[model samples]
Target: MAFLEFTRLDERSVIEYVKSVAALSSILKLDDEGDAAEKLTVKEIGDGNLNFVFLVTNSVHSVIMKQSLPYIRCIGESWPLTKDRAYFEAMALEEQGRIAPHHVPQVYHFDPTMSLIAMRYLPPPHIILRKALIAGIQYPLLARHIAHFMANTLFFTSLLFHSTLDHKRQVAKFCGNAALCRHTEQVVFSDPYQISQYNHWTSPYLDPDAEALRHDNLLKLEIAILKSKFSEQAQALIHGDLHTSSVMVTPESTQVIDPEFAFYGPMGYDIGAFLGNLMLAFFAQDGLVDQPDHRKAYKEWILETIEDTWNLFYKNFVALWDEHRNGAGEAYLPAVYNNPEVQLLAQKRYMAELFHDSLGFGAAKMIRRIVGVAHVEDFESITDAAKRASCERKALNLAKMLLKDRAKFEGIAQIVSAIRQF
Candidate 1:
């Protein structure tokens, strides 16, 4: 009944693991009674410089079995990764599910000892949102759903959910992943901008101007503004990485997965990551538009959604805060909610920094996929070189400018204005 041993797993071993997971599900009565179980087929379906993913499917049932290796398997043994990431991811999923059940996938089983996890398979039901965007189809309701998702999950899971002391305890526990945090911190805040040997964009498809833009001191200063707000905004147990790829969507459904990078980070980190990818998609539209009119139309919708999403988020967030905190006896109640001026200022400041961080991290995410090692399906799907480079450059420029002028950009209006000017 034991699954594949982590210490001795290869690609074929993945098949054995799938069989075991399927068997375990059967024992738990997950499927129909006494039906002959179908042999599980495992296929690789992940996009990143790290980790291996196996989608285990049989005739009547399907599940995902993800295993963490000691190093990047695709890159050989040169790049190291801690298998313990599975443990962190599983734990994050457990907590997030409590606050936002529909937003994340359900985890049926997990083994910390093996650094592996099995969960409900969301098959043809959902496609990665990143892929959907590259095809130029817009999810008119996505901005509202995601904004509400973030507002509810983030507000309730933070100090706002529990008392200050309880929230602090939760934060301290996740902080054990100092190594993971360091990786994100360096990737988002440090390395990409510097001329490190590790930094390089994919050839021919990279914009020389975009590459040089990362080195601008103004952009670095903008990132600093975001880094500064990290503490104040650390009021929640965030998904830590809520980008487009992390979100699964169809025309009528949206479900987010991969809280493996989840942690007690700033609420804005979640917001920024989600919105940042939209900005990435927005700028990449030009490359998708083959025609000027098409580009203008698509770009307008993207920009307008950005504005609407923020408004929806704030309107939803304030209502949640008021609903939960109004008359609730807590030491920090009046101070946190009563002062509109201060709250508005804090929110304004936070939004500005969120814009900057979104840009910086979006740039890092885009660049890393193209150059460093990991690449995204959105850009990779573009078969034409000129088209791909055009999309990447547009994204990279916005990223650089947002990071450079983060402090000066007050709200969505200014940010949108600046983006249009570019």
Candidate 2:
């Protein structure tokens, strides 16, 4: 069929739209002779604030179709946003899948005009990792899988693996995604630090805490540096919103989704986002344990996962850098740093920078979630306001100290020990 004008598809219209496209029709196993709607079911499953997501399925197979709206769906037309984010998401998904196929969903279809993407549906038992964490479920393999995904994607995209020309070209491809980057800049980097209508907290309880963040000159200074890195450093192709909620998982399988915020930014942004959310879940565990059935063992799992993720990521990342030490990477030329001793020294310096970067970025991410426009379900699910505030305050204080003292930490173990302190 020819490209139709952009339409906001509903459950009913979505069926007709799918039937018109044969590939989508076949994905759902719809028979052409019968009414497509009779066999195909379209359920709106989008819980996020931006897109319209439909689970189009027959009894046999399913596909998730995501359509972008022209404005922010959560904030309405007053907060106008371009639908072009879907284009960047599609591009990012394709690149990320090429780099790490096992962790990313295959993009079966994308419609630039319609600002839509249809891809393999991640079915039941693959609930949002955040929800699983909130329920005290442990993904024993999460740290390993996430480490692989981040290491491969970030390494392959950076100058450590690509030529300067290729790296710049790849960066150019994603520069159009500046709008989403700007949104991240405002929410994660700027909004929480100042008085904004969008910013909120467990008020009265955190009223002083919220005010303190705005007035803290030292905190503001550190955030300025992180913000500069976010704005100016095109370290790698990062999954810009790589928090726990962006992941869907089971005990055995993990899949990363929703890269609409994807851009060429600091690699630490992705690492920090994931580790920071896990930290948030850890802090919220105290509030959650009030339930008779809740397990405190889950906190132990989170700590181990945090430690394992960074250690494994460090090991995997250094291994990649070593394997490609003689490759076309512009970051460290094998000829100039010809000796193994020098190579080892260079690797240490580089990894140290990345480690500190992740710490600062992670702290920034944690702080914003507590006081920014968006609040995580982990803290929000706590019924008591004072209890919720208590959890958030601990997380907030940890974040403040870490952001200021991120350079002092030499390894992930110290960070884990600090989480215990909080």
Q: Which stretches of candidate 2 lie over 4 Å from their true place?
A: 1-3, 31-37, 291-294
The weakest ten consecutive residues by lDDT in model 2 span 28-37
Q: Which lDDT values do the candidates have, in the order given? A: 0.68, 0.90
Q: What shift in Å separates residue 118 of candidate 2 from its native position after superposition?
A: 0.1
What TM-score does each of the candidates earn?
0.85, 0.97
User: Could you give candidate 2's per-residue lDDT for residues 296-360 as a string of tens digits?
Assistant: 67888999999999999999999999888889999888779999899889989988999999989
How does model 2 fare in lDDT?
Answer: 0.90
